[model samples]
Target: MPANPQAYRPETALLDLGDTFWDPVDAADFPATTLRFRNDAAAAEVGLDTLSDAEWTRHFGRFAPLPGTLPQPLALRYHGHQFRQYNPDIGDGRGFTFAPLRDGAGRLMDLGTKGSGQTPYSRFGDGRLTLKGGVREILATEMLEALHVPTSRTLSLIETGEDLVRGDEPSPTRSAVLVRLSHGHIRIGTFQRLAYHQDEAGMRALVGYVLRQLYGEDGDDPVRLLDLVVERTATLAARYMAAGFVHGVLNSDNINVTGESFDYGPWRFAPTWDPAFTAAYFDHAGLYAFGRQPEAIHWDVMQLAASLRLVAESDPLIETLQTFAPRYQAGIREAMFWRLGIRRFDDRRDHAVVQAVERVPRATDTPIDRFFFDWFGGHVPADYPDAFDELRRLLDPYTPRKDRDHPYWHGEPCSMLIDEVEAIWAPIAADDDWSRLHAKVAAIREMGAALA
Candidate 1:
């Protein structure tokens, strides 16, 4: 049964909060706009699946707040240490929270934009996203969600007819506006922005608000918050490893308060389990590389701990921060087992199994997804390949979570390789042939459903 949209209260509550953490803003009216994508599946959760294309555009693209939601848009204010260098001048430069809504469980969710327009933090840059950029983000979010990573869902993509020049890609490319549906958009940087101003009241207000809106509580204990953040960050990093994903950027500003992943820029799933493989072209130091993701995310969690000092003592926060490493290790083990589709087994033998599987990939430099596709859930065949002999033997002591007869077990995996992504994008970029892109999205969703 469809949930009553009015049972959702955050949309009204946020509007009543009256721009405490954000500034009122208006969307840039664009030219020759056309809706390019709509996530009906995600919208249905909020009872918005019935919205017509024009209605979706009028609300999402034009920033017209939905009925029973916020009355206006808000460009959230924030500051962050970009690459460990303190940067006070950062916030929602190109995007804003258009409105807040609730899912079936009545959990608060924000429908925010990525290329809406310039805010106070725009500095001297153009506040527009390229059409290709939006498409890449959609692919990234979809693939991550399929891998069971708590990630954002790209709700809509609208091409706003504009020719933009950028050094990162080919100049005079297409432009777009993107809307993402997620648990919340608040970040460690959000609090850091307030701490920079030494606004104690603001910090306390934010802590309380985040606890209530996102965490389902109103407790103001910053230490408890830090603990939750550490655990969530650890689990998030573990999931990234299991999925062979490198987020590319692990800045505090990019880390969502709810621990879900969003802002998919310069992200990639590893072709091979190479620790040093990086996604961003300019990430010369590999600061946010594949294996170093746990380190990067741990650092972000600590920064969040630092911000909590405004309302709590540093000792408890620091003590909670120390849990990140051990939590991350445990998280890795759990996620690794889940990926293999095994819930219970001999722990010692499971360790051996994990080592065996990892050794095969490391030694052969094989694609990580291939291993899962072939041997997931401890499915071992008599004719198994020689490379996985150790893995197969290790599986002898294990049991799968389900019967190994699921249709997904017997085929070439639906891989989201970068090459394949480009193959899908080539037609769209060259001849505006969206058929391939549409097909890829459908295939990816099917693969996700099968895995689920």
Candidate 2:
């Protein structure tokens, strides 16, 4: 990692341009701020590694504006389709892009907050996050990152001195604000908002910014952008399938322009290989279920293509959108290989290796997480029930990573199963004992490092 160590190379790229994509909003000061979690890895990415706990709390927890960053956070504006219904009353109601800074790799990143406070978009609800929700997000990102999925990592979690009332959780739960570190906060909904109002100039400006900031190598052709987004979104869906994870909300607003998965809410990992596994309780039709993720993402990229029609013709966009199926199939095969720590030996063997994992899960009662853990690193234990015999032949051509010797590889896989997550949080909720939470986070990170 290379970087300038002193000050943040902050930019006012989006905010400086005024209210085209976002509205300047001030962060609300919490009554009392206590830092609950800090991501040192993310800190080093930007130039905030050496900041003391007091300083971190002052800036992130207290909502104090960064010295070299934006004067105020930007509450982004966007319209999205919620469960296939057009919803215009949606935007960054509770969160904002607090800062824009660069990393060691010189890629622009956003420090965004959730539960910071209410904005103009906040209709009638309080812009507060339950401590439970914050904890869940940390777990979601930690586990997903370890599995090599493109995702947002939690940077800071601070408990505010307030009790938030949530319908999904126990009443008057502890309130908290969360900051996440990610590549970009620009969403598919951003383009939709522009298109909704027929803001052709705004769409062009946003598209230009994305091309310059993210896909610099790709020329600023709208069709090329559509192609890039389709490929990425396809890969993203494949990763979710390979990881056995379900992002409960597949709304346009939840989909980011960078193709990095963020805004983890009601997320869950499948206990077993079930196609109908739905993460959100409100998903009555199973629209965003595990099996339908690829389809949902296909729909989303189409929406982006529709938005891009302001700059390009429909024929190229339609042609590019059709590539998602083949791309997704290829991506799933690739992701499976990465998860198992193997490289391609031959086309037959590679196909057999991927098929073994998919076919074995449906043929047996083995838990999905356990299936990957037991057979990962090219070691197919004998007890793996109903596993295809061809998998053994596939393993012969593959060499496992030496890092498999880690103790985590031998036991019941360190998993973020729903029961396990609840158990980890039970102590913190009742006794104010955060020992379990800390231990769990450490274990998750260790699992991530070893897996990577």
Candidate 3:
């Protein structure tokens, strides 16, 4: 890697940009002649700093700065199973780790680049990323974070000075590299790789490394490590279901061992509970639909536990796997209750909530996105009159006529709180006044505090 210029160099921090395998000459495969750098807010929370103009071009490509600072680079290496098969040939192909940053809470975060350039893991294809793909990732991270899911944050996107050819869509459209910040990048497949090679020492080393990096050395019991991963996986899976998110690809490579959600590709949030809804075009079999995520996560956990056989026994591992289903269900119930603003968790109420959600038309199905708007905008329809008169008017248009007679109407008063929330968030989504948006968010935070 090249050294940073004096003005761009950090005085106390180590300047460790560029991977050991990075090759600037491989820029030939990219249609874009230059790459640009941008800051990611999510990455910033973890303490990432953007690179200076000269440093960005020298390391990332000849791309210019896009009105943001560039952070130091940090390359990450991990093994993962692709499509259930162990593959040792995977790690930051077109992307490399940018630096780690500390957030307001002092949590260490890693900033990484996607589509920055090519590395040894590029395989046979160009390591460039598409602008559309970058945009989708930004949307995924932003939306998922707002929904309170354990997800990687999309920090920034910089359009390259060139175009790239792809098999899908146009031959040469615009290209970009996205920066994402997350807890850790280690994956379940990372252990699987060592297990497949019968490298017990490597597996042990990797596990120890993970314990030190993510859980601290004091919490390094093999069983405990396995259990933590299982528990976190269950919690994350439940959160995904609550948020209506489908990862589209749950391959081992995409399963972060640290339990943080990573690698957002072909992901989607469902508008309804269709078990077969898929986000990836290539997921023809629906193996990774929204409904299958929990099961897929269980399978991935089993694989991770199996890889730990070198350090522990199979019986205890299988026992850990058995705990996944119940744990996932419990977590899902809790998350759903929070999302719906339910104060109590009763089986009957849970059933009612599910039924009510099923009956409510999706945002895309009608003008429901604006339902709360109309309600809070001070117009109340008479047909669905109730204590939540405003909310009833908002939801009446989306409710089917047949289910209008349900007893769920008893809980109608809750709609006032929901309406208030919508009123607070609507302007933010519309890109209304920034000061007003901040005030609204503050108000929402206060509401959350009051609820607590």
lDDT winner: 2
lDDT of 3 by residue, 301-395 (tens): 88899889988888888888889888886777666555544343466555454444434434234222223222321234454324443334333
Comparing 1 with 3 on TM-score, the higher-scoring candidate is 1
Question: TM-scores of all models?
Answer: 0.95, 0.96, 0.70
Model 1, C-alpha of 25: deviation from truth (Å): 0.9
lDDT of 3 at 41: 36
Tens-digit lDDT string for candidate 1 (24-83): 889999996789999998888787887778888888778777776767788988888788
Which clashing pairs does model 2 show?
A: none
Which runs of model 1 end up more than 4 angstroms from their true locations?
A: 1-10, 15-20, 381-387
